[model samples]
Target chain A: MKNIYSTLPVIGILLLTLVSSALPANKPPEKGGVLPVINLPIPKNPTEKVYLGLSGDGFFKIPQIKAKVVIIEIYSMYCPYCQKDAPGVNELYTFIEKNPDLKNKIKLIGIGAGNTPFEVEVYKKTYQVPFPLFPDKDFTIHKACAEVRTPYFIVVKINDDGTHQIVHAQLGDYPGADPFLELVLKASGLK
Target chain B: MQKIRLANLIMVAGMLSVFVTVSMAFAISDAYKGNIYQVGTIKPVDSKLVVKKGNQAPDFSLPSVSGDKVTLSQFRGKKNVALSFVPAAWTPICSDQWPGYNIIKDTFDQNDTILLGITVDNIPTLFAWINQMGKLWFPVLSDFWPHGAVAKKYGVLRSNGVSERALFVIDKKGAIRYIDVHDINKRPPLEDLVGALEKLGK
Candidate 1:
């Protein structure tokens, strides 16, 4: 009876451990992968156009960002996960803006996976997202990235020759703005 | 022996407490992942729609997820209504469809339209399902109890006790302006819905 009582507690503890350590559905990806230059539309907003160091209209590419490092966030208006992470993403943008050195070196942009132009506008207005957001109404960006799930993050380092390398690619939410910013900076060798 | 029994009971209780806490944490933060069911492709659409365009929308008095009784007549003269009849809750296409409307509150308002999402699922099921979706501006009405009574009235109740993926746009004067019994496997394009609303204005 004594051994059974002792063993029951051990078994209970194991069950508790199992429940607590349930496997995550999608883990934040580790860093590495060089990507082709991604084409992007010129922001209609005049302020956004100037921030990205672009002129005229139509389309531009990721390497065109004057910053040394660029952070691209792939989100969807329909995704609850993206909605949950919006505030953190906005804070991350703000954190970069407040820092003089980081602000000039890092830039952030977002792509609305499978979202129309109108839908992307609604999301931006709803969340008050400060960064330049583009619509992928045709799922072009989504398919290019192997249909990455919403709320995915990718940090890229812009090269001298206009090509960029993917330093980090996380499939789900990050730790937080500060921690994730540190991760991005470290991954880009900026820290 | 009684003391040993007591010890075992205490251990089980402790473990349950830990388990419950972890589950609650996950539900609060990442509820979307665990709640969704991935049902693979079925028939594109299973039911034949009974109501056609220009039919006075069969009036329904279904219970909304907000604990209020919603009637189609309520919006008759005051506001136009768009009835979205989705098949079921927690399914693949059904899950994201409503949340996709979450950002377009303005578009509906501009057209003086009130969207009511109808499903055969009960209120409790809907509450649990929508908790992860944040706050939806429109009321999600349940067509359960008589089990898809409202859906059946509109002729969308499927053979499998669900509804067809359908949309009905009714004008403010209570005339059914458009009906699109969309393919169940795919989402009806937003442009089609928006165009219908825009036409209503003209």
Candidate 2:
């Protein structure tokens, strides 16, 4: 079994190379091969001390702002989805604020990237964001969180029975938050 | 000989069918035409700003990257507004997206439209980046105050505090005549924008 496991991948690669060579020189296989772009190794999970930068207001951190559930909003100023989502985001803020217990358990943070500091400052002023929005100028936070782009979110929670397990991680465009929020609520044991 | 010829024909036909299927899958036909959607139904937003077709455009007093106040009414006189909502600057998508506006700078001018890219990013940041990227033609507006307020009005702000990649073609009358929302992964084809611009005429 061990020998088979070791040989399988190599055998598969050989088969792939053979099949590719058999095809007409002008026409390569339609799928399956190494991509052209430079690939970099990324860690699946972030280590401690690798924190998201300060929100534009200079407040909040990854671990410092402790909560049962942490809702991190990753966005850029000009994205239409981000713009369209602004009101929804405001509502999310309002919803959490209205629920003290949920608010205590759930912490909302916004991280703005890909824009200039001045741009971020303007965004901060215009939105009147109740929560802090961290600026990921260097993309260190983005890499640590494994975010591909803005208008997505990362929801994390400490499990109910303790042990502080990193229960859920979700990322998608705006409308994807409902499911993420549900997972967070479950992780926090909020029915 | 006949048997070999028959086999070859079948193999070629099979390959052709597979090629056609894949091409159709990747084709950029009106993939979004029948799939159009209102921004509201997709997410939650503030009720104050409703940007829709034929609706009198909401007015906003915001600053440009140059630190000048930009008002909706300013473009009401003659120039139509091509408000391209970008996700963020400096990222791969935004880098490609903003430069797209620059490449088509003359298109907006040819159509007598004022193209403005608006975002929550601030002026100094925008100024420096624009200088570096050299997109002097498309003024990136800052909806930084009241934060995402303009985007909220348009129902395009994502839940994450950034605006989605939404394009709005506002006519001289200040009505949102055309709205195209592309999948975040793709940019709306230039042909679509040009086609919409043609409709802006009589």
Top candidate when judged by DockQ against the true structure? 1
lDDT, candidate 1, residue B23?
27
Q: Which stretches of candidate 2 lie over 4 Å from their true place?
A: A1-191, B1-49
Candidate 1, B29: how far from true, in Å? 13
Best-performing candidate as measured by lDDT: 1
TM-score to true structure, per model: 0.76, 0.42
What are the TM values for chain B, all candidates?
0.83, 0.72
lDDT of each candidate versus the true structure: 0.79, 0.56
Each candidate's fnat, listed in order, reads 0.28, 0.00
Mind giving the per-residue lDDT tens digits that candidate 1 earns over A60-167?
888788889989888877787787788899999999999998988999999887678877887888899999999877655554565556677889898888877889
Residue B146 displacement (Å), model 2: 1.9
Worst 10 residues of 2 chain B by lDDT: B24-33
What is the alpha-carbon interface RMSD for each candidate? 11.0, 13.5
Poorest 10 consecutive residues by lDDT, candidate 1 chain B? B22-31
